[model samples]
Structure formats: C-alpha cells, structure tokens
Target chain A: MDPFRKAIKGYDHDRIPVWFMRQAGRYLPSYMKYRQRMGIEEMMSSPDVIVDVTHDPVDRIGVDAAIIFADITTPLSGMGLRVRFLDSVGPVVENNIEKSGISAVEEFDPSSFSHPVLKAISKYRERYADPLIGFAGGPVTLLSYIISDGVDRDLFRVKRMMITEEKAYQAVMTRLTDMIIEFARMQISAGVDAFQIFDSWAGYLSPGEYEHFVKPYVYDILQELSGSIPTIYFSTMTSSYVADMDLPADFYSIDWRIDMKRFSAEIPDEKGIQGNLDPAIVNYDYALHEASKIVEAASGRDRYIFNTGHGLLPSTDPEKLKRLVEYVHSVNL
Target chain B: MDPFRKAIKGYDHDRIPVWFMRQAGRYLPSYMKYRQRMGIEEMMSSPDVIVDVTHDPVDRIGVDAAIIFADITTPLSGMGLRVRFLDSVGPVVENNIEKSGISAVEEFDPSSFSHPVLKAISKYRERYADPLIGFAGGPVTLLSYIISDGVDRDLFRVKRMMITEEKAYQAVMTRLTDMIIEFARMQISAGVDAFQIFDSWAGYLSPGEYEHFVKPYVYDILQELSGSIPTIYFSTMTSSYVADMDLPADFYSIDWRIDMKRFSAEIPDEKGIQGNLDPAIVNYDYALHEASKIVEAASGRDRYIFNTGHGLLPSTDPEKLKRLVEYVHSVNL
Candidate 1:
C-alpha cells in the first residue's frame, strides 16, 4: 500500500509519509518554465500540461503523494463564471453571484464542467504509481471569492450576506455544496486515490457563525465523500474551533498556529492528522531544524503525515524542500 | 472606580464594562464629517480634533471606555519614518526600515516624538470624566509595517527577516520595544487611565515563532507599564496560543475566532478577558441577539470586559452599537 494511504487509514508505516500542500506549484523551476509560456487556464485545461506539472514534484522533490495541478477556482470557471487569474491578485470573478444571482451557480452541471481536470487526473493515474489527490474549494471559501469578486482579506461581504440575507446565503451555499459533491464524485470516478477540501477562508468566521452557516454544509460534503476514499479537510487560522468541530473527515490538515501534540489529544483517536510546519521557515537555511521539531511532535501519535501548514510560497527554495523531504523520510517512528 | 478598571482588577461591577476596539473612528457620522475636512494625519495631530473624535463614542454610542482616536502608524511617522495613509491602502511606510535601516527608529526619542498625541491625551483628560485608553503598535506588528512598508496580509517579509536576518530582527525588536515603553509612560503621564498594545499582525506567526520573536518584546512593554496603569493586549486569530503565552498584560482582548468561556478558563485567574464578539454581526438587525450570546458566555467569569473580538467595521451601524451597549449595561452579571 502507498505509505500516505496507509497512514491515513491509521496503519503503522515504516516511515512518516510527507507531502507539502502545494508541491506542484511555482516553487518548482520546472513548473515556472511552463508557466512562462502558458496562462493558468490554458495550463489547467491541457491534460499534458497537468500531467507534467503534477509529476514534477513526485519525481524530483520525492513527495509521497501528487496533488492535481488545478486551481481551486477551476470548477467555478467551468460553472460559467468569468474567473480570471490575474498576476499576484488571485482568482477574480468578473460575474459574481451578487451581480449575476445564485441561479448562475445553481444552473451549473458539475459532470459537464469538470471534464478537463478529470481527464488530466485519468492520464496521471494511468502512468503514476503514487497516490493522486484531487481537491475542491470548501463552499464558504468559494462563496467568499464569488461574492467579493476577488481576494477579500476581511471577507466582510460574505459575512454580511450570511447575517443579513439568510435565505439567499443558504441558496448559494446549497448550490455550491451540491456542485462540490458532484465535482468530488466525478474526480473519484476519474481515479483520485484521496481528496482534500480546502476551506482556506473558513478561519475568518467566528465559531458561532461557522456553526450556523459553514459546519452543516461541510458536514454534508464530508459525509457524502466518506467511505469512498480517505478525505482530508484543510484550513488555516482555525486552531480555536477545529478540534471541537469534530467533522467526520478521515484527517484534518491543520496550520502552524496550534501545537500538534495538543491537537492530537483533543481530536478523536480514530482520526489521523496531517500538517503543519510553517512554510516560511522552509526558506531559511536552518529549515531542517524546524522540520525536525514538527517530526518530534508527531512521533507519539497513532497516525501522522508531515506537511506544511500552508501552501508553498513562490519564493521558496526547492533544494530546501527536497532536503527536508529526505530528512522526514529518513525518520523511523 | 471606572467599571472597566474595576472589572480589570477582578472586582465585581454593576455590569460587564463594554467597549469596542476602533470605537472612536469611522463608524460615527460625526467622525465622517470631520474626516471629509481633515486627513487622518491632521485629525491625529490636532488636539481639538483628537479630543472631539475620542469623545464621540462615549457620548453617542455610550461605551464604558474611550479609546483615543489615532492610527497605529502615528508613532511610526513620529519616529521620522515617511508614513502616509492613502485612502484605502492604509499606512504606507515609504521610508521602511528595509530602506532606511534601524537607526531611523533607534535615533527616535519617544518623549520628543509623541508630543502631539500626548498633548491631545492631556487636553482630553481635563474635560472628559470617562477613562481614556491610549495605545501603541506592538513590536512585531510595528516591524511588520516597517519591514513590509505597508499592510502585508501574510507578514512574510517580516517572517523572512526573522528567519534569515536574526541580529537585524532582534535589534529592530529591541528598539521598538523601548520606544513603546516610553510612549506608554508618556501617555500615562498625560493622564490617560489605561492603555492597549495592538499586536494586530501577531496572529500571522506560529506559536513557536511567536514565542521566540514576539512574546519577549510584548512582555518587556507590558512589564514596564504594569504598575503605572492597567494594560490591555489585543490580537486577532490567536486563539490557539494566546492562553499558553501568559504574557504580563492586565487583560487580553481577543478576537471572534475563540469562545470567551473557553478562553477565560485557559488563561490565568487573576488576568481579565475582553472580547470574543464577531464585529460583523453588529451590522445586522439582530445585533442584540448576538451581543446577548457573548454576555451569556461571559456571565460566569470574574474579570470580564465586553468588547468586539476585533475592531468595529466601517460599515457598522452606530444605532446598533448603542443598543448593544444598552443591552450589555442592563445585564446584572
């Protein structure tokens, strides 16, 4: 069995399986060379480009798993939203739900929309032995981009909708939730060995607000995806409430804000844990010293996977990441 | 004694002393009228404008305390850094520490630099019977601005500096720490009853990183101001590690990410907890219902101060804040 899959299943492995959140990204020089010629949309839609980019990290950096080379907004663009990847300014929705109404999203057919990425996944699976991971943006995080039309730091617009327009908020959430489930199911059919739900913006909400608006939809998605394949939920800045929420996912990929030892103790014993070295430290010369601290913290746990708390920064040194991966693979917990 | 002061001292009060961070600026109509005529620099520097803006919330919204009206970057400008407040971009430091070096900050005499705000504090003290709260930016947060040259959501530049340039980072932290101590002491002498240190960007760091870089500087500033006046330390997205830090501030003003009941239990008994309210909810029609929930959670704690988890948004309705204050003041606990 793949070590990453075995660890998530709570089985003992020879060594801890390791992968960074954004292994197949700009930090790799190979990906950058391709990016210079192709736009994000062009690169995402091409199965050949996707296969090459996704395999680069697994082949060169030696990560245990290969996450699909697709942006979280890829599905939104497929759903007929005018999503543009502006340089530096992330995914911008030209036709936001507020301007075009929830019907725009509700009308989306996930089966028809996600074919290119699914094709890419199928091609990758045909050639690669490593477990391939597929992912979609969590409902609230997707809604944040759709409502705000871009990257909003405060996420005030979405919070306002959640607070003021309850019915409309629910409608949007329901549609997005349904779309994500379909998207996940399609990816599973396309042969993804595992899945991750990236609720990157969920940390912006209070626990009470999250309970009221986000938890039920997330619960639904996780429930739907459970048992088919191992599932992981990832979010940053959510240390205060993540442990207590106890959503029914196989694993929780946490950020660096909280300690792994304390987080492991708080969550149920059956569930596995992934993550959380601060990605910034990977840029430092003493990167392994910091990575070793995370390794030691997770040593006593029943199930653990080593990974960064957040996505790799564009400025990260690939050599450092390679060395860190080598060091984690050498550990025999 | 002021209700806020009494509550901080762990004494029983008539009601939970309620105040909102950023209470004195933006939301109020009177402040907006003033903003139309004067730039933030003019408003912050003028004793009359400062006194009037500082008193608006206490007089109109009826908060228990009066936090002075001033931007966090006011002192950076005072230290001879070329800081400017662009309409929406926030504090832009043209002569950032990276460009100007640490001497620009090291050469700063807090006593000479902070006279305008100190003079404003004195002027407000003579006329206002309400306890006035003064504040300074926390060292790491100040360095984040000084290093990045503006509002950096990630604080990656500062983090990189901390990891790669250790001696430079420590020197900057040392000088900023000393400047804050002097600034707080000057505010104390100017007759302000209490103070807050806003480490607004401290949440960007992991626990271990925070412990190494931010905690000591915060401790030094809090230690210096401990006996002089009650001190409050405010940071957002820090629920995971704030409890364990055990910094020497009289109160910890937390954000909406954590529950007040849980937070109160985790920290020291002698210390006070202020906030945990989602400020975004204050804009809703059912604001009182949300406010009541916070009051209920805080009912059991000894040293509790009712405040929003973060600053009040510019869109917050002043009427809602007034009603929320009335509702909190009516509570017996």
Candidate 2:
C-alpha cells in the first residue's frame, strides 16, 4: 500500500506520517517572511501564494502529509460574511450572524464564496506530491460565528438557537453542510490525494445531535468525494459521540482529553485513529526529550497515527518539533 | 448523608446536585440589575455583591449547589500588574509578565487570598445549606492567563516557558500551587462544603508533563485538603492523562468528547466521577429531554454525578437548564 494509504490504515508508517496541526505556520521563519512581505489577506487571496505557503513545511521539514494551507473559515467568506484576518486577532468578522442574517441566507450565492480556494487547490496539487488534505469547518462551527453575532467563548448564541429556533439551526446546518459537501467534493475532483473533515469544534455536539445535525451531511460530503480518496475525520473533545455515531472517515484525530485505552478498545477495529498528544507537553523541556515515552503511554494494539491533542502553538521550537518527529518515528510499531 | 457530603462521595442526590459553571452572570436579569447598580469594578471588589450573586442562581434557578462567583483571573488581579476586564475584549492585562512581575510574587499573601471568599461563605452559609463549591485556577491554568501575553489558542507562551525555562515554569508553578494550596485551604477553612480545582487547561499539558508538573501538586493539594473537602479535578480533555496519573481527587469532571462507557471503565473506581456530557446537546431544542437520556445512560453507575462536559455558555436559556434539572431528577437508577 502507498505510505499515505498505510497512514490512513492506522498502520505505523516506516517513518511515522507526522504533520503539525498548523505545520505551515509562523514556526517556519520562511512563512513569517512571507507573512511580513505578503500579509495574510494577500497570501490567502492569491492561489499562487497559498500554494507556495502550503508547501513551505512539506518540502522544508519533510512531513508525511501536506494539509492545504487555508483557514477553516475560508468557505464561509463567500456568504457575504466579512472575515478579516487582523494580524493576531484571528479571523474577525464584521457582522456576527443575527436573526437578520439567518432570514437573508438564501440571498447569498455559493459562487460568491472565495475563488482563491479553488485556484489554490489546483495549484497546490501541482506543487506538493504528498497527500493533500482538503478540509472544511463543521456545520455548527460555521453557524457559531453566525449566532455569536461574531465569535464567542462558549457558543451561547447558537446554543440558544438550538433551543429556541430549532428550524433556523437546522436550516443553517443544512446550508453549511451543503457548502462543505461541494467544497470537499471539488478538492477530490481536482485530484487531492486525501481529504479530512476538519470539525475542529465538533466535540461540542451531543452524540444524538451530532448524528442528526452533522454526521448525515458529513457522510454526504464523503460520499460526494466518491469515497476513493482516503479520508480522515477529526474533532476535539468528542470521544463520547464518535464512539456511538458511525462516521465513515479512515481516521479520528481526537484531543488528548480522551481515554485512549477506551477509545482504542471501542472504536471499530477497521478505522484509523490519529492524535491526541497534549500540545502543552512541548512547554515542558522534559516532554521534548521524552516524546517516545508519551507515545508509548497512549499507544495500544491499533492503527495509531501520532498527533497532538490540539494545534502546535507558535512558541514550539522547531528543534522540539523535529525531536518530536524523530520520537514518533522511533516508536512507530 | 448531607447532600454536600454525598457530593464528595460521588453520589447522585435526589435532585442530582446541579451547579452552573458561571451560574451567576449576565444571563440573569437579577444579576444584571445588581451588577449594574454596583458597577463592574466594585462587583469583583465587593465580596458582598459577589456573594449575593453567588446565591442568586440558587434562589432563582433551584440549582442544587452554589459555586462561589468569581473570575478565574481573580487571584492574578491583586499582583497589581494592571489586570482589568475590558468591555469589548474581556480580561485585559496591560502588563504582560516580564521578570519584574515575578518580583511581586513574594508580596502575595495566600492567607488573604480567600478572605473575600470567606466573606462569601459567611454571607450565604445559612441560605441554601447545600454544597457550596469554592474554585480557583490550577497551575497550568494560571500560567495561561496570569501572564496573558496573547491569545492562547493552544497555550504557546506558557508551554514555551515549560520547554525553555523549567526553573521559571517551576517558579511560576510553585507560586501558583502555593497560592492555590492557600486558596483551596482557605476555602476548606471557610466551612464550604466542597472544593473544585478548575484545571480548565490541564488537557493542554501532555501526559508526562501532567504527571510531573501538574499531578504531583494536585496530589499534594488533595492530600492537604485530606478528606476535609470533596474535590473535583475537572478539565476539558485530560482523560488521557487522568487514566494514567494517580491524583488525590475525589472526582473527575470530564469533557463531553469522551464516551462515558470508556471513561467510566478507564478512570479507576477508587474515586468518584462527574461529567462527560456534550455541551452541544444542551443547545438542542429538546436539550433537557436529551440530557435525561444522557443521565439515564449514566444512571446505573453508583458513583457518578451528572453535569455537562463543560460549563454553560452565557446564552444558555433558563428553560433548557430547567429542563436539564427536571430530567436529571426524573432519571431512575
């Protein structure tokens, strides 16, 4: 099997198919210079720049996969939502989704979504030969910005919608899921090696709601991708729901908060498992030196793709990450 | 048994010992009216108002327990390094910790830490006469905020400290642990029914680091609290580490991402367990109705206390919460 295929099988690759959550990030001095010169909006807007930046870490650090360098909110930008990446104040929106916006949802066109993404995908495919993960925000996540009136700490606004305006919430979920299905399908058609559904905040859903509101749409998207592409389904703090809900993805990248032994035991034998190391462990110098021990602690007799509980922070030294990579390689069973 | 004592023992009460993470807040009309009258700065300053608001939910919502109303950043506020809650951008610290702020560390009097908290205890002692949880930020949590450098999407600044400056991290950790030890001690001293260490960010620390930097101190704190207070070592996603480490905690509050069957199985039976609910479930229209299903799922367990995976969001409706309460009460073991 292809190493990438082997990777999705939960098989330990010859050199552990390791990739940082945000590998193409500020941690790369090269990317910093690009950010300084081009600015985030300019880079995101230009497919050429997106392709160049996407390959920055793959070619440089030599990881197993090259996730397309794009923000989770990329698809939603077409919906007349002004998502501005204000240097440091992460992906800010001018208008948080209010009842006004929800009622007017049909007025927006899917074509209005950003064009640079398609251009970037076509271009990035040409640049990096490794598995390129095409991903999108889960339905509820996109709906969060809409409900919070902007960005909120606990997503109270949307949660309220779940209780009060169940139909509106369902309508929003249907819309975002439809968008993501198209978004992800487009990537596979464009010849991306593998696709992963980045449900970064999916764990927020109860199993029943996840199954009702989310899984069907995600399953639809995966099917639209033609199922030929090896796919990874990832979420944070979602151990309970995923166990009960049958998702068709090849891997589940969970946060480190899960009980690994139980997760390993319960998740169906055929599926792949990724993640979840404590990203903060990098903060402990001892952790940098002892990554192998950490892996050994979480490892079980299953296909485990070693990754962090969450994204690697900006402060993580390249040297520590390098050490972590070597550490995972050493432990690949 | 005293309901508070039952809370410590991990027994589900007749009403199932419910308390909202931030029970008293902007959501309540009464809290808003009181807070508006007193002013925001004076709200935190005056123990009277804080205590009154702490008891507000008990009077209004009929929650089983009342958590002391306070900010996670309260302890760090006194260091006089210019910490204030901003109207638009919550919790503004004008001064990010340089080495100079560390100098002010010695001036911190841990005994005085819980004085206002004691005042809260005195104020509400006879009112509800149930479990009154007193909370403080745990080590890594304090490190995340006390030195609020930037958006800690993944706790980078603090993790970098742990990696590069073990001594510095330890110094910070020791001070925080000492302060918390003092804080928790004071809460215990104040005749509060139980204690909850809000290690909201504990899931950020990897297993090894958690075992080293976090657990030992937690063990010591629990050892010191030593059967006096029922403790809940609650965090978002630390189940991976909690399964491995031996901490002297009476209970664990798990995130909803974890499947309860696995969580219940993996977490040793020596201590009681609470939580592992999907917060998004709370957002569903039949949230309380669905929550009863969740409680029913976990109902057979002898040592489980029911709660959400995390706290309620600011926008969580009173009706949904009321439903959750109704459902938990309706569940049959």
- Whole-model Cα lDDT of every candidate shown, in order: 0.84, 0.68
* Model 1 docking tier (incorrect/acceptable/medium/high): medium
Q: Write the per-residue lDDT of candidate 2 for residues B170-200, one digit (tens) a residue.
A: 7767777777777777666666777888888
Candidate 2, DockQ score (0 to 1): 0.40
Q: TM-scores of the models, in the given order?
A: 0.97, 0.84
**DockQ for every prediction shown:** 0.71, 0.40
The TM-score each candidate achieves on chain A is: 0.96, 0.88
Report the poorest 10 consecutive residues by lDDT, candidate 2 chain B: B99-108
RMSD of every prediction:
1.7, 4.2
Q: Output the TM-score of candidate 2.
A: 0.84
TM match of model 1 to true structure = 0.97
